[model samples]
Target: MQRSSYRYLVVDVFADRPGAGNPLGVVLDAADWDSMRMQAFAAWTNLSETVYFLPPTTLDASYRIRIFTPRQELPFAGHPSVGAAWVSLETGLVSDTDRLVQECAAGRLPVRVVGTGPQRMITLRAPRARPVGIEPPPQALRAVLASLPTAGLQAALWNNGPSWWLMELEDDAAVRGLAPDLAAIAALTQATAAVGLAVFGRTPAGADHDLAVRAFCPADNIPEDPVTGSVNACIAAALDAADALPGHDGRYIASQGRELGRDGRVALQVDADGEVWIGGHVQGIIDGRATW
Candidate 1:
């Protein structure tokens, strides 16, 4: 079999500075590649997520993208969506449109870009998320949470595309000090069909961000994700549903991945109608081609 070369870009999503957020691989042209090839390449890259850009099947969409993790393909993912949009604009794939319509297994979604150059920001109207209900802590979940201080903590299940078990801790300290049982977490996620457990807490008063967040997904071959847009979106949706979020502000920032030495900042906004938008600044890191 003959292998083909493709243009690829590596980008950091939800970061104000380079190398401060979740890294994603974007294959700019993958029309000829099949699903197996995409998955193989994604696993080879060893990134949390990789995306392939192809021509849109629908006339309304500017382009279509497929998201893949190291293990399998995902219908949708937040950082991959944002990173794909940035790569599209940067590579002139959708130059004529300010708002990009993306087609994926999750359906068509819209992305808006603001500013330019290093200051450029991209926001995606997240897929509609709803609280599935609170999950009773099973034995596996209990094992994972045993080391963490859980007093006054609240947990719930939310679905945006991937199902997540969201936990709100008392403060940033609790969130940051977690040493989770990855084996237990993997067992729980696999048994429940959830992606993983996501924990967050309120930041110190007057801090630059409103919340501190961390995600654990050993089941997905990722021990921890640096910055996760989908999980943050679900957190917002869950908080808004319970009326627990800050009342005075519809827009806030979430700080994540600091424990891993990453400074990821995710921008979140809730519309008057209660729709959530997840966005942040994306930086292009590697401009190169891949042959496999």
Candidate 2:
């Protein structure tokens, strides 16, 4: 009944401090694990996502990772990418301390690190997000948005590795106060081939962050994702396209997961070249071994 024990870590991503951000589980010695085993462990963790690292197949990459949700494998995800990079750097697995390349199913991505120790921030250059057409599911979308005032703002569907439907409400209060009909949202996401629906709104001035954000993903079995990076990245792209950034600047801070009692802040930026990057603070909370 003995099985191999692999080194694993649980890290907080995007939190200003411990126990405040999205939690991610990572396995470092999974080079030989098959997809079935990876999925099983990912399901057991039941995190928004879990990642397994393997030796890089490409010469230019620092490492390769396979990402999984409880129900399926993901080509790319924001938190997992950041978490994996942080662990790699912390464990001395990274080739370049300043910036490293992460190879995933989505592709090779750049991971940039700033500062050091607990103050370190890791950022991932997200795949460019673009609004795509979906089969009209206005009925379900309307049902989910019922009783909410959505004027002058439009719902956008974007695919940036992890697809999502993004909506910008009137203000942060509306975004936080929303209680969407989950069933309707589930139907719409299923029909559109998206992971879920996310909403964001402008926070009042003097707030710590520029926006409030929340995500619903019944398809992925996540009712409300604490702090979502992929969705936030796409939202930044959408905002940039519309030239609607709060300060007409290229970047802003977002606050999420407060309703769930966890404080997650995501820094979003659209660079001059139009690439959206998601950055946040990451800390290793638990470093241990896992038997699978």
Candidate 3:
């Protein structure tokens, strides 16, 4: 029996509150594992996604990371990238090095660690977002409205690298308390070939945040993602069209998880040049060994 040692970190991307943000499991030092083993390990953790860290085969990068969901492997995932980078930092994979690069199936992405505080912020460079072609049926709008918690809001669809259904609510409160029908959403999204749906609105009357959001993707097999970086990316593009982003700086704060009572938050920023950066703090959850 061959035994392999692995360290896993529980990280919350896009939220400061412990249980509020999107959860990810980082398995550090997973070397030479095939896709089948990786898939099994990811299903074991059962988080939104689990990132496996591998030593770089070449000197071109620092580490190799693979992201997997319980159902399948993902080419790219936002929270997993942030969580993996944080795990690398915590595990001493990268020292006082302010800059770190990780190789993934998507490609090599560079990360810039801002500060060393308890809630350390790290910004990741997203690959060039090439919008894919999707022609959703006219019923997409109606299905979206019917599945939403609020019926009074207007919904718009956008393709920011990934297909996204953007719902603009009447108020921050409306966006915050949304309860979506996952099965319905998944069916519609899959039928329309949309990646997922993003619900958003202005901050509540007494809220400190700028906007509230929630994402649903049953076709992707995700139900009520606590915090979604890809959805935020789509929001960035949508807001750019509305000229709603402050100073037109292309950077904004997106709030999520409140609907689920988790209350997670994500920082969304995009440059005029179309570069996107998403970040948040993370915490370690568990670590152990895997025998196969």
lDDT of each: 0.85, 0.87, 0.71
Better of 1 and 2 by lDDT: 2
> Sort by lDDT, best first: what order?
2, 1, 3
Per-residue lDDT of 55-128 in model 2, one digit per residue for the tens? 99999999899999888898888989988988888888775388889999989999888977668899999988
The alpha-carbon deviation from the true structure for residue 136 of candidate 2, after best TM-score superposition, in angstroms, is 3.2
Single out the weakest 10-residue window by summed lDDT for candidate 1.
Answer: 147-156
Preferred candidate (TM-score higher): 2 or 3: 2
Question: Tens digit of lDDT per residue, candidate 1, span 89-195?
Answer: 87888884568888998899988888875577889988888876535657776776666665443666688988888877778888989887888889978877888
**lDDT per residue (tens digit) for residues 193-249 in model 3:** 676787887774455567788888776557877887767766666666556763236
What TM-score fits each model? Answer: 0.95, 0.95, 0.86
Tell me, by lDDT, which candidate is best: 2
Model 3 TM-score relative to the real fold = 0.86
Better of 1 and 3 by lDDT: 1
Pitting candidate 1 against candidate 2, the one with the higher TM-score is 2
